[model samples]
Target: MIVTISDNNKNKTIEIKEKKLISTILSESGFSFSMPCGGKHICGKCKVFAKGNLSEPSLKEQSLLQHESKSDIRFACMTYVLGDTEIKLINKETEILTDGYFSQYDLNPSGINYGFAVDIGTTTVAVYGYDLKEGILMCKDSFLNPQSIYGTDVISRIQSSIDGNSKELQNVISDKIQKSILRLCDEYQININLVDNIVITGNTTMLYLLLNKNVRPLASAPFLIDDFLGRDVTASQCGFTHLNNANIYLPRTMSSFIGSDITCSVLAARDLIDDSKSTLLVDIGTNGEMTLFHNNQMLCCSTAAGPAFEGVGITMGVMAESGAINKVYLENNNIMYTTIKDKKPIGICGSGLVDSLAVFLSLGYIDESGYINIDKGEYITEYNGKHAISISDSGNSITQADVRAAQLAKAAICAGIYSLLNEVSLKPSDVDRLIIAGGFGSYIDVKNAAIIRMIPEELATKSIVVGNAAGAGASMILLSEKCRIENEETAKKAEIVDLSTSPYFMEKFVDCIMF
Candidate 1:
């Protein structure tokens, strides 16, 4: 069977061996479709238009499309193909951030002249090439992780792994990383063979999915990791023979949820380790992992913030890509905003989401009690027959459900922050510095974040956006043995706090749901 994806006056066709759901076929075709609810038919983001013989939509599909009259539109994950069909993709071309790599650590060249520092994030994968001989960063690149087709968050991927899709997940990540390495080498006009080492960092679940390890332990309560420590392997060991002799060094993971990304982040952010003052380090991705440093002791916790921040669950959420509204404010009684590249607005990203909510609250369009004055707001617009607030000139808007998702995500992160502070007998004012890491954290307006109460107001001015600390720390380990040793020691010293078992955390989480 042949399936076609038509978008922007272009069509690309791919052949399928057998009858299958459009979502499965699309995934096989290497397109990163957003399945925010892990293809459970809960999220309608994967809706596509069909033009040929196909099975009838299920009751779930009918309910999802009850308000619409177009019979051609159906959920891709729920629609099964009976014959050849042409599928019109509703989602735009995914744009990923390629820049914004920063680190405060001093460079220390090692025996390897060329190497790769990789950050295997749940939603994206970024790589940095290092010229160890000259102690400089040579090239950097990033793209959406292909494994996103299976699921956006780690738990979904873990379920897929346990369901016997581990090999496929492993292959996708491996291929992308190898291609990134080759792409870097080609861009710099260097031989791929010259790259001698690769250092890796990610959440424990991401690392497990990459290595094709058993994720059954993480699928339930008492999340146990038999061996979460970092390992040294070769390119061939992980099935990437293209880079023959490159050594793959994975940083040590802190706990089942608190992974190596936090460990690497701790290495990159020196402010978190200062003894003279207390500090908070937050890497807000799908998993909002944070660390608190005080008097040479570190405390860490992880929260399931979901994929809303990375543009996965919301109505028109997107990554920090071209055409994505990344900032929003009011100028002279008119709403003003900025996109990633000043291009046409397609959707709002994490930064824009926070900014929009903050602006709405300031303008009285939304109340501090989480009520939207939908009937009276000037920016009020209709989206899919529902009331929405416009954030772009293209009629793209945020629905009430989208705001609720943001509330849940923000609440989780905020709850984690306060819960940690409460455990240390410190208040928000006591925090000397709050370092925000990760792709979303880096691009977010700190003041906007504070206004939304996703972050504390007291630490807003003290907040610093250290772009991709995990990736930077990965580069540090790739270039210097000193960094690797120091990171290992730091991971051992850090303590993981289980928020699930804390009544105080639950109470804080409930209280933080409001604006």
Candidate 2:
């Protein structure tokens, strides 16, 4: 069987000897397709347009596809190609957040030639190439994390690893990063052999998967880890055969859930970690990792915020990409919105989701309890058998279930903030700065975020949008040996707060769920 895959107008044909899932064919063909639910027939997001010689949709696939308007659309994971088929992949141009702010540091290169700093995020991976001789950044690139095919969240990926996909996960990400680095070198007319040092940072599970370590620890209670990993290994050891001369340094992880990404974030935002005043640093994504620094003490916790904020789980959600609604507001007593690049609205992203919830609350379309009153507004319409607020003329809408998903996600973040504050015996007003770190955090409207109660309104004015601080921190670690030492020390000072066992967290979680 021959499968013709079309992505962004590019066509690639692959030969398959036997019938196989479209997802499998795509994966084997080196295409980036997200199966957030690990191909368990959940998420319903792996939609692709297919024609000719495909298996009939399963009952589960049919039910999931009911909300989809196009009859030709099929779930890539659920659909099988028995013969020659043409598949049009719905591959969006992702708007990855790469630029970040890092404090000035002394130049101290670990190697003589080129160096690369990588921030391996759950949803995306950013690579920064630098000139070790001149101590300047030469190039940078980012892509959707290929491991997303296994799942979207860290837990999901961990579960995938536990299901014996560890080697596969490691290979996909390793190969992607290696290729990304080589591409950067080729694009900039640099020698790949000269890339002598690489600094990589991510959550514990991400690093574990990168190293192909056992992930069963992260899947259960106690969440113990064998290797804390603030050490260096050869690129060849990490399967980066292209950069055989490079030494890959994995930053130290604070806890099983709170990974090196937070460590690097703190290092990047070191100025905010002042001793005189309290500061809270939050990287809100699939895992809501937060750090509170006050009086020389650091308290960190990880909350399972799920993938709602990243536009997963929501009825009509997407990554921050072209055509994605990235912002929403009220104009002339009417709901108004904007998409990335002013493209046609496909669905809402995290920032837009926050703004939408705030708009809905202010307009009284959503009650204090988060009920979407369909009778309250003309935009309210039924979608997938639930009340949804239409966001676009093309029929894209935020369903009631999406509101609940947003509530749960925001509540997890807000509750985690409160829990940290309660631990430090400080109120929201006491925090001098609420440093919002990460790609999603950088684009969000602080006012809308506070309006939705995702963060304390008091801290809204104090909020600092530090874009991609983790990547910046990773870059710092790559450029400075002192920064690397600080990264390790910062990890040591953090005291992990297990929210799963905290009654206060539970109490705050319940309260924050009210929106």
Candidate 3:
């Protein structure tokens, strides 16, 4: 079999004669399948199209094919052949990743100056527009993390770095981000050099890799950095743009995993965090970041919650994009969907996962112990008796395995919150306000989140979503010089919590695993 990834490097191709699992072949071929659920054939995310011999779908794949399988689309995880074949992969569709990755020299007062901000999150990137003169943002946009070439999660990227291919991984991802930035700049008809400053906020590892800094230390151990913050760099140096030379600002980081982005989250929510008697800022993304304020002290931590919540690390998980299922409902005792683009559903992403969990729990599809009754196959009705989870062109069912993946993710995140409460000797009821940051948290239903037990009931009661805090902080830095310094102080004051080494966290995770 000859498998090729479109648009990525061609030199990395491989020839496989043995009939190995699709994931095994892709993994060895230097192409990540991003099937976070260990390829159990339950999650229908590993879609692919073959161009050679034996191109028909397998029985396991026949069910998923009804939703998004054109003559071209096939589930990469299930499709296998006896002879040579050429396989094509699904390209991740992203939007507004960044704005040219450059800074403007001056403002155009009369017309929109079109200054841009980039938020380089571990899981995704968000771009925002602002008027140079008035220094007000026009709109905001976001997309999946272009660095998914390494793997779906930052830890996977770290593993890629550890394999002695760190530089190559960095270059490939950085180039993708740069191209996205250039496209945006060209579309807006603005000179890239005219952008005032390129302010980026990301976790330490992401920021380090973008800067082409050696991140070997971040893989394990004490997990420290050479510096906390940075302020000057040329766009061309980082492969962003050659159009301009701008002072790039990075917020000070509290620890190795927790970077300036958390501080930025605080900055964006300062209006609420500072005024409220007790506040919790939870920035959920690839890394589960949380900060709790009590009396006069601020405590923060980053949890290794994994990427199942955002549609990676699962068999059918995907980032939010066209054809990706975002919402599910119990329609006539069957699962129905609201896809992102009204297209045929290919796979389910984060929001869909949350919604599915809630629906299944309410409908008794999953037991109180989170055990999916695989024996009751009728409860798991197939779309036309096909194996896949969809009932219509773009609708699908949530597999028991998908529910389990969500269970693991929710457990980790909820455990972090529970541990935070334990440390303060308080309960979830003690928190006055809960501010959920990041693109994923912004649009999800707080009540639904509580019902599914993704979030505690008390915290969800007082919760509000603040979209893309990293972008918000970066926008503030582009507009105000003081924000940079304030971020440094914020990082210093935040107390760090290490969940990996905490036994309390393990217990909390176990308790939260049930539906």
For all candidates, what are the clash counts? 0, 0, 17
lDDT of 1 at 210: 77
TM-score of each: 0.90, 0.97, 0.79
lDDT tens digits by residue: candidate 1, 53-87: 78987888888778555768988889998888999
- Report model 2's TM-score to 2 decimal places: 0.97
For model 2, residues 372-467, the per-residue Cα lDDT tens digits are: 888986788888677788874646788888898899999999999999999978999999999999989899999989988898899999988889
Cα misplacement distance, residue 475 of candidate 3 (Å): 0.6
Which candidate ranks first by TM-score, i.e. highest?
2
In candidate 2, residue 137 scores what lDDT?
91
List clashing residue pairs in candidate 1: none
Query: Compared with the true structure, what per-residue lDDT tens digits does model 3 show for residues 1-515?
Result: 66544533343456777675555555456553455333557556666666555546767677677766378676665666545666666665632223321122122232234466677776667767666668766555565554554566777777767777567656655565556556677776657666656677788887777777778788888886777765666676566645364455566778888887777778767777754487888877667789989877888877877778777655566677778787877788776678877777767778887877777677666777876655544546554443333323454566656667778888878888888877788799988999888777775767778877778988877997777666777777666666666667778888898887899999988988875
What TM value does model 1 have? Answer: 0.90
What number of backbone clashes does candidate 2 have, counting pairs of residues 3 or more apart or in separate chains? 0
Judge candidate 1 at residue 326 and give its lDDT: 85
RMSD of each: 3.1, 1.4, 6.2
Which candidate should be chosen as best, given lDDT against the real structure?
2
Q: Relative to the unseen true structure, what is the C-alpha lDDT of residue 478 in candidate 2, on a scale of 0 to 100?
A: 91
**Which ranges of candidate 1 are over 4 A from the true structure?**
2-14, 31-33, 47-75, 85-111, 271-273, 375-377, 392-394
What lDDT would each prediction earn against the true structure?
0.82, 0.89, 0.68
